[model samples]
Target chain A: MLTPLFEAVRPIPAIALVPVAILLFPADEQGIVFITFAAAFFPIMVSTRHAVRALPTLWEDAVRTLGGGRRHVLWHVVLPGILPGVFGGLSVGMGVSWICVISAEMISGELGVGYRTWMSYTIVDYPAVIVGMLTIGLLGWLTSAAVELAGRRVTRWLPRAEEAS
Target chain B: MTLGITLESLSLGYARGPVLNGIDLTIRPGEVLVIVGASGSGKSTLLRALAGLLPAHGGRALAGDEEITGASRERAMVFQDDGLLPWRTVRRNVELPLRLRGLPRGERKAVAREWLARVGLEGHEDRLPRELSGGMRQRVQLARALAGAPRAVLMDEPFGALDAQTRAGMQALLLDVLRDTRATVVFVTHDVDEALLLADRVVVLGHGGIRTIVDVPGPRDPAADRTALRAQILEEL
Candidate 1:
């Protein structure tokens, strides 16, 4: 049911929303942040939805027959079932968020990596643009890694690295 | 004490139409009843109806005199797929029922350990379900179902996917466990050999209500002088 909405939202490039964001938001900063959130939200939603939809129907039946009600099943089964995929989505979402946010900033913003890159280009400051690009890349990598690390910690019951493969 | 179940004019199916029509039978407490049939014969449908999974079509199932409105702890089901939560360890999966029932953690752990051992998964307690072989995973599922000490265990082709040797081993393990516990079992399978080995009374389901319910005499071995019985069942199917 929610799938079609997600489908419609998933494919359109976040950069396509530049005009819409500029018109909707009162300030460039807020507009960029909204774009960043939009970019992140769709990937997470789409990935998590697929994860949930792909779960075996029998697993829910198993819980029900064991005297688990709907709430019980959600907590003990559904949430745990989707965590790995959800975290995977989070990792991807973080990367895309950076992309959209920087693009929005470059289009129209006083500061941020994207704006800095654009300003450097205007002044022909090639080295400063490179540094901004590098910093953005580092931040994105660190955030994604943090999410992956958290996923590993919580899902410790999963088989270890070698056994998983 | 184990619980007996009665079904009266039970019709079951999906939204399109009824797959199983007019299933009326009583499973005695502590009895091992195996239902056998070809595909689309509604054997699995009947099992699901009894498990309170299939919504009421024309009639209802009763646990003793009480109508089975929905799933309850009295009836636990073992699915064809080993429905182990991938995120939990084998021991934790077995402990799930106890945890749901709000048992004290220590007692739940002990019971989980005992049942895991019974299923020959003693040392593999901490391992996740993904790490286990298909046969071992099925064993863990069985242990989890039985650990609840439920009155009835409804199994739908729990060993159908295993290799012949592994299927035989699992069948033997199930029989051993069933013999030791008081839980009544309604095992569904397409394999005639499996039905004969496990059933005290083998029920062949087809054309709606039970096609036939045959009482197997002592020595429930497929290799025994059961050619006559096998022929009779095959003929019915």
Candidate 2:
């Protein structure tokens, strides 16, 4: 039911929502957070939906025959089955969120990497700008790595085909 | 605690069209009834109706006194694909039905381990389904099905995907396990030899309904001469 609305709003880039976030929130900090969240939310939601739909009906039937009800199917089969796909989405979302957050900070912020980078640009401090850019890249890489590590830990039951060697 | 299954003119099909039309059969308590047919002959469809996974298109299917309106723990199904939860460990997969039944965690664990040992899958409980061989995975599926002590077991070519050697081993293991449980077994297979080896009564499904029902003279006897009987079943197919 929410697909239509989600589809309509998804195409509007999260970075472009800076003015709207500024108007909606009382502080720039809240606006920046909102923009970051918005950037992350769509990828996660779309991937999760696809994951749920792609699950085999056989699993649900197996659970049902074993006397499991709707709630049991949801918890046992659906949630765990979608973990790998959800993690894929989370990784993408983390990357996208970093881009949006940095952009939002540069557009409207008193402090942070994006602001510092923009400030260095105005003052012709080329080395400081390079440091800020490097910091942003580092932070983005770390967050994505964290998500992937968590994903592997949770879905450890998945067979690691390459590990056999 | 085994349950007798009666199909009173049961007609099964999908939204496209009917498969089996107005079929009447009685699967006795503790009896092994093997359904054999060519492809698209509705053997699996009939078993699904008994398992309550598929609704009867025109008639009713009864498990003991109650009508089989939907799936129940009393009738557990084992699929050709094993149907073990991919993300769960072997032990956890076997414990699923017990967990669904609200069994306490410790008791569920103990019972799961016992079932796994019975299927000769001990010491591999912590492994995932993907880590196991096809034969071992099928054993896990069997363990999971019987863990709850269901009154009836509906199998849809459970060993059909296995190689000949592994299939024979699984058949022997199944006979050994069936000796312990009195559950009525409705097994579907395309192999006439397998049907003869396991079935007390062989149900030949063809041309949209049951073609014939043959009673094996002596079931589960590997040394028994079954050439004539095999020929008769093949003729029906």
Candidate 3:
């Protein structure tokens, strides 16, 4: 049910929804939150669903035949099976959310790097704007890196596909 | 604790229609029964039914006197896909059934180590499934199916992915493991030679039913006799 809704919204950039969020939410905080949520939610949900669907039926059968109960299957099989995909989505979502959040903040906010960058531009403080841009870039890279690190830790058993060569 | 299996006029199907029917079969304790058929002949359906992985549309599946309404830990399965949890190391995959049975961590680790070594995977136990070759992964799967010391093991094309030489080696390894464990085995494969090599009795399936049951003369038949049996089975097909 939610899959269809996400599929519909997946193609549209969350930044594009900023205008609708501003109109719907009374507070700037709420609008920014909504934009960020929109940016993050779809990728995570879609990838998770895809992971579950892509799982081979043979895996479940193997678990069941081994006398694993429903709870056991979920704990041992399904949860571990989807972790890599979930982490992948999370990393993507973090990047996307930072993009949308900064855009929303820049358009209308009193604080944050985005707001400061826009404010400096208005005052012709070009170096300050460059500093703000650098700051946002640094923050986005750090957050994404953190997500990647978590992904690596959780999915340690996964073969390093990128390092196969 | 070896177990015999009995199927009584079992029928199974998907939403569309019946896939296999009238499967009244018995596998003696410690017996290896290989089901062989053409692709899409519902051999897998029959194997799954016997393993209690499929719902019976009609009739019954039993592990001895116990009615098998669903999969049980007593009847472990080695799937064609290997079914190794990609997130788990080889040892963890082998120890999976032990974990499901609620064995304590130390004992589980010990059992997993023992089985991995038995399967010639002692040093490779820490590797993930994807890091191993197809044959190595299959050996892990075999260890996993038997590691928990289940009474019966169900196999679906267990060695179908291997090269001829590797498949031969695996067949030998499988025989050795089963000899030691005495677990009732029901193996499904399309390869006639594989069925003859591994089975006490080969069940030839056609049109969703058992066409014939061919008894192999010995554990490892001579090459000439093996060829003869293969030709005969091919004729039956």
Candidate 4:
């Protein structure tokens, strides 16, 4: 909702939001931080809810029979059960946040890879913009990959694809 | 033994549906009681009521002076399937109840190993439930129930799913475990041979309540004395 409104004005793309951010909040780096947070929040929320809902009833009953109180069951059994889903959500959210931050800087106001990319574009410096994009892609890929790896490690109880083979 | 169970006007069913109606029964401590019934006659419901897993919706279950309105740690249940945690190794699964009870690590592992060894699962501790044969997983479930050190164990068709030979072996193994531990056991099964093999008293559930709770004076060896006892329980069924 907020993104389309921010994007309506023409000369600046969303990416330019970073550079002018310093002057708007000169004492603290609040604006850029808030923008990054907004980009990653929703996907993480939805994925985690999906993970929690998918846990088997038997697992929950087993925990209860073992004398786990509500809190213990939620933290130890429920949380671990849904971790892969939550991590998947977080990874997607984080990757999108980084990708859009660069794009936001390029299109909108001031500092960040996006702003630098747009500046290069204005000067007809295509290679610099390409470099900005490659950097964003690499960072996003690495972070998402790291999250997926962590999820696999945590859900080691599940049957692995190799083992099934 | 001082422990005994009684249910007074115990009526149990789902929110609206009926399973048991105005039922009353008594089980002596260290006694092996088997409940037999037709399909959906509530033999399993009786076990659940006995274990305190079933709410009255209408009736009351009492273990001596204590009321069992919900599941209690003092009783453990073994279902038809091995209810082993797929994620944990056999040893870890057995150790779970102890860990939940706040038992220290060294002691919990030691107790877990002893119970595993007793159930003939000594070397299979590190193996996950899926890696083991069905019989082995059932033994692990048995070990888990025993490891909790419950005063009574509730079994709902514990060996009903196994093949004939495996079922016989599991029956023998279960009797050995029960005899060794002397825990009061409430077993629910439609299998007459199984009931004759393990139970000291066979309680048939029909006509809404305990049709009969018969005492069988036979040798503990099911494989040995089963010919006569099996016929008797079959007649009762």
Candidate 5:
């Protein structure tokens, strides 16, 4: 859903929430973590649901006729069928969490990439802010790309996104 | 132990309307009844109704003396589409009916392998349905339907999709198996030749219902002179 797209880019949006969090949560790290968790939850849940709904009826019928009950079918068939979708959602959620964590730190309180970036900004040290942003970008990309790779390996049955396109 | 079918004004169809209207028919022990009709004429629907796969719109069906309105576990069906689960191996496909019946795993495996061998798929037990050829899949379906030792076997054009040569071979195999099992068979097909070759009595079903149940002469043989009989049935149609 729209949640995944927004959460994946949450770090960029977290900068904007700095003023509001500072007013609401008394300048603390707890508020920053709270914001980060909020940014990742929705996307993961929605994508997993979509994947679960898209499985073929033939799979269920085949299992049932082959002597599998409802529980066996759900776990063995439905779970594996939707694992790729769940991984996709999870990757988005993780990327967003890292982004929001850094942004929350730099703008609202002490700690995280956002906090250090803001400190550098106050001292007019453009290099430090640039370094923080570059570090966050590189780390986020590596983590998300790792997730995508793992997803592909797990779902070798699914066609590659580029090839399918 | 004789297999018999009794239907009292059985009506069958989907949500829209009845595919086969209220009609009475009986399949006696060791008898093969071929229900012939054109496509969409509810030939398959009638077969499915007999198998208890499709619910009746009206009336009832009894296998031997037990009613088929509920789960009878006495009837097995081979769908026209070969309804083999793509994920299952040939052996497992044959074992499915037994598994559904709640037999132990060891017994299921032994019986499944026995039936798979009977269908000439002994070495291909582990091969998935997708890996098998069309004829092979159809044979697997037959093995699955017959493995449970059902009282009646309903086949909806089991060989309808196969090549001519393969279809003929499958028909011969089926006749051989039927002779051994003596299971009451309700074979639905559009081919007059197939109906004539396999059925003890060929029922030519036109647009409305079964027009006539023609008592075929002598034991059916495809190589025999059935041309005159075919023409006679066509005239009746």
Candidate 6:
């Protein structure tokens, strides 16, 4: 039921919706936050749906035969089975959120790395703009790395075949 | 305690059509009854019905006096592909049924460990399913199934994917384990030799029904000459 709506909204770039976000929200911060959330939500939702669908029926059968009900199957089989895929989405979502948040900040009024960088560029402060750009890059890399680290911790059971070699 | 499964005019199949029709059989308590047949002969279907994984198209299946309507912990199933959860450690996988049964964490851990030891998977308990060899994974599956102490075990070609040497070792391990428990076993295999070796009675299924039920004579000896019996089962297939 929600697929058609999601599909329609998914193709519209979050960055492209800044004007609409400004119209909808009372504050620039709220608009920026909304765009960031929108940018992250789609990838995570899509990956989670695909992950749930791709899970093998055998695992559910195994759980059921062991006297597990629907709740047990959800806890033991479905949730863990989709962790890897969900994490994949989360990592991608983090990166996309960074892109949108930075872009939104640059386009709107406020204080952030993107706003600072834009301000420095307008003022022709080359060194300050470079510093602001570096700060944004560092922040993006750190957030992505944090998400990936958390993903690795929860999905430790996954075989790192390439790493083994 | 072991369970005696009764199939009274049980018919099983998917939505398309019936696969096994009007099947009637009584599996005695504590007996290893192996069902053998060619591919698509409904051996696995019959096993699935016994496990309550598949519903009967007609009539009823009974475990003792209770009608088999759905899956229960009383009838555990082992599959050709080891169904151990990929994310769980070997010990945790074996402890799954116990967890489902609402056993306390301490008791679940103890029972899971004991069963892991029984299946010779002691040192590998902490490892995930993907880390284990095929044979090792199957061992973990066996431990997981038997750890629940189900009254009956319904196996659908559980060892069919293993190589000859590993299969033989698994067979020996299974025989050893069977001697210790009274769980009624309904094993489905395409190999006639496997049926003869493991079964107290072999049911040959063909043409959507039981073709013949052969009683394997004597003390379940592997060394005994049975060329004639082998030929008889092969001919039925």
Residue B142 displacement (Å), model 6: 1.2
Error of 6 at B112 (Å): 1.5
Which of 5 and 6 is the better model by lDDT? 6
In the range A6-49, model 3's lDDT, one tens digit per residue, is 67778998999877987998565788889899899988988898
Best by DockQ: 2
Clashes within 3 Å, all models in order: 0, 0, 1, 23, 4, 0
Task: Score residue B115 of candidate 2 by CA lDDT.
Answer: 98
For candidate 3, give the docking quality class from DockQ. Answer: medium
Worst 10 residues of 4 chain A by lDDT: A6-15
| Candidate 6, A50-150: lDDT as tens digits | 99999998999899988899999999999999999999999999999999998998998597899989999999999999999899999999999999999
In model 4, the fraction of reference contacts reproduced equals 0.40
For model 1, the DockQ equals: 0.60
Tens digits of per-residue lDDT for model 1, B53-164: 8787888899988999888878999989778888888999999889889999999999999999899999999988888899999999998898888999999999999999
Which digits, one per residue and each the tens of the lDDT, describe model 4 over residues B53-101?
Answer: 6677566778767988666667778877657777788999999889888
TM-score of each: 0.90, 0.98, 0.90, 0.85, 0.72, 0.96
* Per-model lDDT: 0.87, 0.93, 0.87, 0.77, 0.77, 0.92
**Could you give me the TM-score of model 4 versus the true structure?**
0.85
Residues B52-163 of candidate 3 have per-residue lDDT tens digits of 8788999988898999888888888888876888888899998889988889999999999999888899899888888898999999999999987899998999888899
DockQ per candidate: 0.60, 0.81, 0.68, 0.40, 0.21, 0.79
Docking quality category of candidate 1 according to DockQ thresholds: medium
Give the TM-score ranking, best first. 2, 6, 1, 3, 4, 5
Model 6 interface CAPRI class: medium
Tens-digit lDDT track of model 6 for B1-237 = 999999999999998899999999999999999999999999988988888889999989999999999999999999998698998999999999999999999999999999999989889989989989898998988889899999999898999999999999999999999999879999999988888899999999999999999999967777877788888888888
Q: In model 6, what is the error at residue B52, expressed in angstroms? A: 1.6
Please list all clashing residue pairs in model 1, or write none if there are none: none
Backbone clashes in model 2, listed as residue pairs? none
Error of 5 at A75 (Å): 7.3
Fraction of true contacts retained by every candidate, in order, equals 0.72, 0.83, 0.91, 0.40, 0.17, 0.83
